[model samples]
Target: MTARPVIALDAMGGDSGPAAVIAGAELARERYPKLLFRFYGDETAIRAELARAPRVGAEAVVVHTATQVLGTDKPSQVIRRGRGTSMGLAIEAVKAGEAQALVSAGNTGALMSMAYLALRTMEGINRPALAALLPTLKNDSVVLDLGANVECDAENLIQFAVMGAAFARVVLGVERPRVALLNIGEEELKGTEELKEAAMLLRAVDLPMRFEGFVEGDKIGQGNVDVIVTDGFSGNIALKTAEGTGKLVTGLLAEAFKTSWLTRLGYLLSRGALRALRAHLDPNAHNGAVLLGLNGIVVKSHGGASVRGIANAIGVAHDLVVADVARKISDDLANFHAHRPAAVDLTSAK
Candidate 1:
């Protein structure tokens, strides 16, 4: 923990290629002088970007990688091949203690696969969830399992809540973030037995978090919950829907302003407000989608992210290391699980 934080970035993993990734790395260093990076990708491509970037201390951000992880390849197959692939090699850097964490804008499946294989999960976490930050009226919300796992039961959901709490506390500075399960209704007995049982499970547990009961879908963008937990199926839908809605609104706003002189003039008047709204809703501000429950921090950025997106993600990795989130998670889980009930009957409803 005393060593300087070095982030392992898969330069070739995002859709933009190694150029954007390298630029992001430079931006990160410029923003944080103490920031160091280990870029993993094709040597030629990485070196080219470094040449064009602002002068950074040589050897501070080294290209310690070989091949690249492609979007087309299967995660399982790629993990097996172990082709000096960017994602694979990046994880290796962390596994070998050369880096504090790994960040990728490439394939989500590949990142999770390689991360689980290399770092494994924390002691008490049964499965890790991909937690993304979505903009809302209350600022940002942590939505988990954006499609990391297809199926999860009550216990798994509870675990995600705990991990999400620890993360929000560390990163967002929320001492006790409110946890919510996505449901059709807010009533305790609203959904299936799984929902009700999970609610009970969450309340029964002694987590270092605040469980505020279940949240509805409409509450997602309204900031009703700090941590929105759900099965992968539903969580993925909410994530994609919110993204689509944001784009749709922004596109419509642009079109409306271009149509007429009156609207255009009005738009000019409102441009400042629009920009502020855009910035608040901008996904880049929440660039880092953390793969929680992993032993090491793994930040997953949008595959088609711009240089700015990657840069923000690097800043996220830096923040995570500074907060010592992983160690805190390990410590919290050790205590929580130790006092958990042996077993709770969660039988299916008739």
Candidate 2:
């Protein structure tokens, strides 16, 4: 029999705290009985919620004790002075091999900092990238360097592509995914010096992936590239813009139908279409953000995530552990580095 995938979740990290976490956990337990969960938070609050609405057959939700670690706490303080904090404990659980993965809707900075400090980086990766998954018209594409490392070098960008490619292959179940460097235009001469240089390096390297050349921002959701690579500064701005635009459109549609009777009638006529649109716009569908290049799997969910959002994030983390994504990523990169020339010395980049 296969061993259950164990995950350590920071229940106190999100805006919805123990209640949202509890609901999400219950949903996941019912949806996926094979998953084993360990929640870290205040024992009293969790037990109180449990008393009010107990989840039957919740043996998977083990309680890990921690005093407190708010979303506003500093990463330095959380890592050093604070020992029993929820985020701290979750990272340590992965480090100690007690958990296959760690999921948190806490401070993104703290999660990344703690994961880096705890599990460290894999070989050939100087700084790990936070790959926010975007559901495109076709397959999902990863936008990496999502505010993790603002300043990345040519070598860093190239290595990010390798990592992103491996990630898509395992988590996405693509045999050989298409990898592309995100630039201003599809032409190789369009992006900044770093992007152009990185594209050249990637062109020369013998990656396990198929290089789809350069891709622009407009090509993100066009199903042209499976993985979109860029620096944190650029990637973060693009991601926020896409998210903001999606929200604006959704809000506008809702207001348009609510204002007048004719519009309401039209909306009623297209209620099924609107429901499909709303389901597509739900952030829970794209809730998973993997902090790639770490020794273990660590997924970060949106801090403002709802119950369904947290549950979906848990589901993503469960897949990563079960697929041995961490090991596969490290091995794939290791092979690519051995074949590539001595350019950046990625063997020491970790």
Candidate 3:
């Protein structure tokens, strides 16, 4: 039997509080039976939720925290005074090897800050990038620098491609995943110097992934590429736009179906397909966003995530731990550095 993976949870992180965190753990327990948890938060609240989820309680150990990181708190504040907070304690568990991974539904900035400071970056990684699976027409695509470093340069984007490809290989189970840099146009001369430089270096490097040059924003959902790399500014905007579009399309569909008897009948006929679509677009299915390039595995769950969403986040952490994604990333980065042409300068011009 495979060894159980222990995960640390920031029980006081999300908007729904400890109850949702525990409930989500219970749900994850059902999916991954060989999972263990270390919950960090208010003992009383955690115990209360655990009582309602005895199965999860059976596999959980709660560590009480006197304070918790607030959504409004800045990243710097959390880094300086957050050691005692629930989020801080949870990350500490991972850093200390008490847990293989950490799953937090707290402030993104705070999570990133603490994880970065505690775990630090990997040997070849300049900065950690936020990566997540985006639903697409063909299959899920991994997009990185979602909001981690807003002003990344060519070297950063190149590193993101390497990291993102490794993530795709592990999570998506793709061999030689198709990688591309997000650009304004597919043409080589269309994007900024950073993108052009990144693309040039990526093509020169003999990496594990298949570099597919550049792709436009419209091609993201088309799923022609397995990994999309960009600076955090553009990547974050693309992510938000995709999310908003999914919501808008779903909302419009609901309103359209309720317009008349004819539409209602049409909806009834296509109910199954509609449900599938809804499931495909559900943020809960893609709840976890990983802070890649960190020394330890850290997954960020949406603040407003439901129990199911939180469970998915935990599942993502479990997958990363079991697959040893960090090791794969390190190996790939080492290969890239070894094979990179001497003429290519990886320094950031910004």
Best by TM-score: 3
Query: Least lDDT summed over 10 consecutive residues: which range in candidate 1?
Result: 341-350
Runs off by more than 4 Å, candidate 1: 1-3, 54-57, 61-66, 341-350
User: Model 2, poorest ten-residue lDDT window?
Assistant: 341-350
lDDT of 2 at 20: 83
Go through the candidates in order and give each one's C-alpha lDDT. 0.82, 0.79, 0.92
TM-score of each: 0.93, 0.90, 0.95
Clashes of each: 0, 1, 0
lDDT of 1 by residue, 12-68 (tens): 887788788878887887887787778777777777777887644375455555666
Error of 1 at 313 (Å): 0.6
Error of 1 at 251 (Å): 2.0
Name the 10 consecutive residues with the lowest summed lDDT in model 3.
341-350
Tell me each candidate's RMSD, in Å, in order. Answer: 2.2, 4.0, 2.6
Order the candidates by lDDT, highest first: 3, 1, 2
Query: Which is the winner by lDDT between candidate 1 and candidate 3?
Result: 3
Model 3, position 310: C-alpha lDDT score: 99
Give the candidate number with the greatest lDDT: 3
lDDT over C-alpha atoms for residue 64 of model 2: 60
